[model samples]
Target: MNDSDAINKYHLSVERADGQTDNLVVSEGHQQPEDVASTRLERVNLRNGGNVDYQEFALEQEMILKARGASKILQVCVMLPLEGAYSMITPEGEECHFTPNQGFMFRYIGEEVTFTLPGHQTVRSLGFCVSLDVFKRYLDNQIPDTIKPMLQPKEIGSLPVPFQIDNFMRETLDRNLQVEAQGSLKQIRWEGTALLCMALVEEKLHKAANPETFSLTQACKQKAEAALELLMADMQDPPCLADLAQELSITEKKLNLIFKSLYGDTVFEYLRSIRLNKAKNLIEQTNMAMKEIAWTVGYNHSTNFSKAFTRQFNITPANFAKKARKLTKVS
Candidate 1:
């Protein structure tokens, strides 16, 4: 169909919970429609007012997207809650599943194929589409050819981002949408696109099925150590594995493995040790109440903290504090 005909055939609009209004214009037959697609390539703030519920599917359908035959490269940014299972089979026959708290990427080369969103499960997601040519110009050959395949016929899933990164990306997208209403910033848009692509490629490369993984390398170990130190450095807000994993750009499973191999304890156990050690120092130096000390050591309930303390130090927190006081007084 001609551009005018294609435009007439397809109805492109900005849809929100309250209503739908015309925002995006794609001439029908200009491109094959995507199974699920969203973007604000022209207007930035186009996504500022849309709410889509958790989608669940018992069965999957074929997913395909045909962009207008324009030789423009497209970058699609998607954000979804990591709480359910999602799988994608690439045109090349590679199939994979991503568990909760993870995200993946898929690239297309204007081919038509079946894209499926399984039923009976719910996830909240936001997808941003960009022209591929724009992306190529932005990276200027810094993007590896090996990585270029990611932009076409590839499936990425089950990778988690640090909460900070997740929040940053979400906020950036939101802000871009808002700014787009005022005007489009091509540089800023390109930067956002680049960041998303870098994150996707970095996550994939780190988690590749190889023995010499990124997290296992010495440099990565040092980086992890620095991150762990920062996390424990603030005893008041001790970090959780999930939070730390996001910051480190590795999965919780891999973090556990690395911590066990290097520190001889899982991340949880290590935090407990830190808390216990702090409690011991407090017991020796101060005549604080057990409950008070427990609170100071990152525990809300004294009873549970005391049990954990005893398990680690071979004595109740109260008794340890008493003995510690006596030792200090005598000394």
Candidate 2:
């Protein structure tokens, strides 16, 4: 759709090869009377009856958006706002706020909801809609019967922002939206991504439902935190997991469990993250040599450090430093 000075509004209709249509109405750069503005819409439909819709809205001033719609099919909606917080009011007057990384899951059954955004802010959201049968088939009866109630119509489920999954989801959506593709290839990509998204959500919900997977108590959390502090304080030459667990007065298995529960990473993975982050900062901010930086982060040799750094950040230390310096100079 072309941006036009005379056209105050644009309605774009996208027909997917899978026989789905997207009707989008976007603003023409000028703020609306309600002070809410939508820049554009990106939508993809899959052959499996799932669809992904993305929109970026900017608020020139504070306003409330009243959206009323009914669904002809039973579907699950997963929504994530990439920027700014917004309060949502359901038709029944139920209200909640959503932020970045945090998401809302609901089995939407034709209910209207209003979203309110503050002034001078932008909000980007990715929404996934999958028919009930498709969603259940993907789960393969893994979800417990107790949690099944959350899948009832109008029942909303809250997710605690699985960061790794969110990062992957956002990157996948952004890449697919930016790339120029048509028909079957685009539909295939969207289908694969939608499945992956559902897999991540299922894994998270499964973990939450399984008692053995998450049983960390307050005491266990404190012990895990203590272990983490020790790991960070002595990253150059940290103790092994067994010895650390010994120091914390917990069994190694318990140590591993609680650490993973509290920090979302294993003990060694946590150390690696700390090591890499410190190395990245040193590479960017300081004039430290590669070998020195490697040794500082507990890697005995620069090659191993380079491999780990590249595995984590997808950039070699030298290249990262070079780019950092170049960007710094330009700035």
What are the RMSDs of all candidates, in order? Answer: 15.4, 11.4
Runs of candidate 2 exceeding 4 Å displacement:
1-38, 58-60, 141-143, 150-180, 211-331
Error of 1 at 296 (Å): 17
Per-residue lDDT of candidate 1, residues 1-331 (tens digit): 5432221222233222223323334431122223233321222222221111112221122222222222212333333432234454444555544433245544533232223333323323333333455445445646553345645533342122221123334344445434442125644553454455445544444444232333468966875686679667877677777888888787887787777667766676677788889888888888888889888888898877875675455455666666678788899
Model number with the top lDDT: 2
Q: What lDDT is reached at residue 267 by model 2?
A: 75
What local distance difference test score does each model get?
0.47, 0.62
What overall lDDT, based on C-alpha atoms, would model 2 receive against the true structure?
0.62
lDDT score for residue 121 of model 2: 50
- Stretch of 10 with least lDDT, candidate 2: 1-10
TM-score for predicted model 2 compared with the true structure: 0.53
